[model samples]
Target: MSASKKARAAARLSAVQALYQFDMEGTLMATLLDEFHRHRLGMEIDEEKFEKADVAFFDDIVKGAVARREEIDAVLSQKLASGWSLERLDKTMLQILRAGAYELMARADVPTGAVITEYVDVAHAFFEEREAKFVNGVLDAVAKSVR
Candidate 1:
């Protein structure tokens, strides 16, 4: 991927991580996102470069996903393997599903395939190959439902 695209993808991954933190721990989303930026600055990464990144869509993405979490989880509970409930899902996989489904449902400008592929790729950052496949499958189901 191009650097700009990579940065955007990174932002999405960051957003997903923030969402996971909020969902799993009841953290305030605003505090989490701010903490994310603060920690990134502490890490000495280019704050301006990251801030200038195409992440304006992130808040919408995160908020939409959270707002419809119950609905999204219902979709997931229905579409995943028979034994796989949303609560039983791997954290990264659940985050991937949430991120991709959020874009699929709310961001009509983004190609469904792009959202799915990007999130599946993001899943690779923390999951095994098999986990990416699971993400792919769940997101494919989500894409079909949204379409």
Candidate 2:
């Protein structure tokens, strides 16, 4: 991948992780973002060095997703099948969905396909192919509604 593309992908991954952390820890967004920028991005952990990420893109995704979470969740909830609510989703999957929906709704510069693919890839990082496919399907539905 090109440097910028790789950076954005890494940013997406980081955003998902950060969102997961925020959900689990109840950490303030500013504080979590600062910690990620200063200590997490590109840092070595578990003997695996992190990829360099686009700081601005990372910030935009995390901040935008959190800022518009309720709106984003409402949209996601609508796209879900009957009897399937946002609360029923796995927390990690919910974060990925929220991030993808935020990008689709707010970042016009990113193509819809790219937004869906990136979040699917992020889901694969944490889950099996089943969850990745779920991310793809949900984001596709969300893109149709919002993009």
Tell me the spans in candidate 2 whose CA falls farther than 4 Å from its real position. Answer: none
Residue 50 of model 2 has an lDDT of 88
Q: What lDDT would each prediction earn against the true structure? A: 0.77, 0.93
What would the per-residue lDDT of candidate 2 be over residues 1-147, giving only the tens digit for each residue? 898998999999999999999989999988999999998887888999989999999999999999999999999999998999988889999999999999999999999999998888888899999999989999999899887
Error of 2 at 42 (Å): 1.2
Model 1: per-residue lDDT, tens digit, 9-98? 867877787788887898887886677766741244654444333456666677788888888888878888877788887776787788
Q: What lDDT score goes with residue 39 in model 1? A: 71
Give the clashing residue pairs of candidate 1, or none: none
Among the numbered candidates, top TM-score falls to 2
TM-score of 2: 0.97
Q: Model 1 segments beyond 4 Å from truth?
A: 41-53
Each prediction's TM-score versus the true structure: 0.85, 0.97
